[model samples]
Target chain A: MMVTLNDARRVIAAAETKAQEIGQPSNIAVVDAGGNLVAFARMDKAWMGSIDIAINKAFTARAFDISTEKLGELSQPGGQFFGILASNHGRVMIFAGGVPLRKGDEIVGAIGVSGGMKDQDIALAEAGARAF
Target chain B: MMVTLNDARRVIAAAETKAQEIGQPSNIAVVDAGGNLVAFARMDKAWMGSIDIAINKAFTARAFDISTEKLGELSQPGGQFFGILASNHGRVMIFAGGVPLRKGDEIVGAIGVSGGMKDQDIALAEAGARAF
Candidate 1:
């Protein structure tokens, strides 16, 4: 199944709630199974630069079918995917803040968050993924 | 050969000059023959949202070997290439402000401009392409 706009909205709402709870304005994005953007929101005062980063993070997560946190580890120097970030026309984001949405064993979509510290972004993204 | 950094700078500078003359702060980008970004500049007070658009417009021009303005016409509803924007991982921007850079009938690169109206962006991109 694909990620519907309605599904993306619910995920974004949950991430927004978590961001509010943590007192961090964030940019959140959702991508469908085809890695196309489904929904996005930039909370007031969120970093403008993070808009691209948030969308690409979700694309990277769904493209590789892995959490961006794990991808970041593997993409570090001396790791298997060390140069992968340069492969996707600069769209791959090897960092925290991206989590895949799964339906059973199938990846249905992904969520990405930005405009906060790495930990905060990860937490917010995971919160969104869980909502999915 | 691909577009060199020096050439990209010259193109951006020319575009910036034109933008200044027209009183429109803008985002400008250049891509090499391989469709990789060579350079980019966002003028003071330019819309952050145009950064991605500027870069992708350059990419689209080079990818199609035609101006995005022309492509936009063919991509309109009921046109032969309608719905083409849904391709290219959402990077194909079928709109104004993208112009191919040519050398002796060979397309060597492209320039993209944004953060202004359609005519302004087109004029700015043309200025950059002329420089190239």
Candidate 2:
């Protein structure tokens, strides 16, 4: 099954809560199995430029079925996935804060967060993914 | 007000139901005010190529704040937007099935439907936009 409206809203709420606890405004995005966006939220005072980054993070996660951090490692210098970021019309994100949401064993969707440090973004994203 | 995840999902669901009633599996896409994808659904057996078409349609609608059908009319030979099809990296769609979602007097987002005839696509897309 897909990530319904209920699930996406729950994840966005969870992410927002985490961002609030951390005192950092954030942009959150959710995309389906096909890497299509389902929902997004830009918190008050969040970095406007990070909105696209958050969306791309979620798309990258769903496109590759891997977290952005893991993709970063794989895309390091001389790594197999190096230069892969140029694909998909330059929409691939290789930083952090993107995670696939699973239903049992199948990947149903993904969550991405931005407008904070890498670790901070991942923390919020992880919290959101848990709501899936 | 932005089209939240809840809003996008409701639109998609409405579009899906309309497509089902017409016996046509469709690819549906929703984009936020900035023309970024918010959610997408590709019904089982929907035409794969239509996925991108649906997405571009939504983007185009949001970009111009006009229905694709209207855009198409204006894009005919000797019309004002005749050459607009080659703009935005060729992502513009000039056809039916794309409509802006409005909140009060504001254009909040847009919905696009593909995988059916132009009339069917427009009908489903209209049903979706009304959900916003």
Candidate 3:
């Protein structure tokens, strides 16, 4: 089953709480199983440029059903998925902060966060996923 | 000041209420004064294709400080702004369902609605703008 809007809200709330705990304002986004945006939030004073990044990160996570962190590893220079960012109308975000949401063994959706260092963003995203 | 995430939520809520009253599942988006998306929601069973359209409609409204319906009229053949859609990386949506949010005389943001007929979209957008 796809993630519902209520599920997305909970995910976003958890991510926001994590960002606050880390003192990092963030842009958070959720995308459904179909890779369509379900909900998004830009915390006050978050980097404006990160809005697109956050949303695309979620899309990338669900697009391949893999964490964007792993995708980043695979898309490194000379790696198998290198240049993959050139596809999906440039919406493939290859980096941390994108995590797939799972229900039992199936991926239901994804959460993406931006506006912090890689580790911080990843932490926030993981926190969000845990709430799902 | 630009629109905040809280403001975007209120706007989306109003638009969603209007959509429900009219029996239309809609994609709703809100953009701040900088034309950056503040928040977005895709109602259950909403047209997937309209997700992009809804977001861009809000962007187009804020980008030009004009309702997309007005922009559509201007972008028509033989109009002063004909062919303007070719610009903005195809983010310009020249159609109904986009309304600017105003504070006093200043434009602060915009709301966009999709997943319905032109008139219905406009009505929903107007409902959102009214709430702002």
Candidate 4:
């Protein structure tokens, strides 16, 4: 029915296994349906900066219900809802690496991970989701 | 035991599905451990403003271990940690929606989702997390 606590745990487990498989340390984070923190983790060699980035990605995906990539395209000049985020608030990063958690058309929550290249981060996150 | 990249993906998927089920057309966001933007999606008819706010929420969550609401509480004039975030950085929002990812005691990252009211924002984020 939702991205329950049990689901969150499953996501983390899968992500960890993927990170290890890739031979790269990582930091992963999870948020509730409302983007509230549910859990977190950081591997030994993960960059300190990656931790924050990972969390933001998860939140962004959950809040927007779309990939951060879309945000970038929309941010371009003449696009919709541009620069409004700056006026409304700060903390909007237009990169990539975060993904969402779902259950048959229902929004549950989201996850974010960092510690390697952008592609690696994305791969790991996707891997974690697939595992779940 | 901690949040992982896989965990990040699952969270977003759940959040997306929840928004759809609610019929609320929402904006969701996710971030990586470094607070970088990752995945984001805006429902077919979601508001333009709520989208960016969602991403920022995610970034804030990843950047701060505590919730954005907690960050707001700590932003007091003489709190243990004052406006240091201002001096240290420029884009840090303190509000709800953003939350951390964790595995046991570990912190992987976090997530943030918007669209819908503040309570709604939090509600959906939680739902997505649970679903995943």
Candidate achieving the largest TM-score: 3
**Can you tell me the CAPRI class of model 2?**
incorrect
Which regions of candidate 3 deviate over 4 angstroms? none
- Stretches of candidate 4 above 4 Å error? A76-89, B1-132
**Model 2 chain B lowest lDDT segment of ten:** B36-45
> lDDT at B33 for candidate 1?
70
TM-score of each: 0.54, 0.71, 0.95, 0.50
Q: What is the DockQ of each candidate?
A: 0.03, 0.17, 0.83, 0.06
Candidate 3's displacement at residue B130, Å, is 1.6
lDDT of 4 at B81: 51
Docking quality level of the chain pair in candidate 1: incorrect
DockQ of 4: 0.06
Tens digits of lDDT, candidate 1, B21-104: 999999999997757688999999999999999999999998899999999999999999999898988899999999999988
Q: What is the lDDT of residue A132 in candidate 4?
A: 53
DockQ, cand. 1: 0.03
Q: For residues A1-86, could you state the per-residue lDDT of candidate 3 as single tens digits?
A: 38888899999999999998989999999999988899899998999999999999999999999999999999999999999999
lDDT (10s digit) by residue, model 1, range A18-109:
99999999999999875768999999999999999999999999889999999999989999999998887889999999999998999978
Ranking by TM-score: 3, 2, 1, 4
Query: How far off is residue A105 in model 4, in Å?
Result: 0.7
lDDT of 2 by residue, B19-119 (tens): 98999988888888888766666776677678789989999999999999999999999999999999998789999999999989999789989889999
Taken in order, the candidates have interface RMSDs of 11.9, 5.5, 0.7, 10.7
lDDT of 4 by residue, B18-72 (tens): 7777677777776767777667777775755476667777777777676665665
Docking class of 4: incorrect
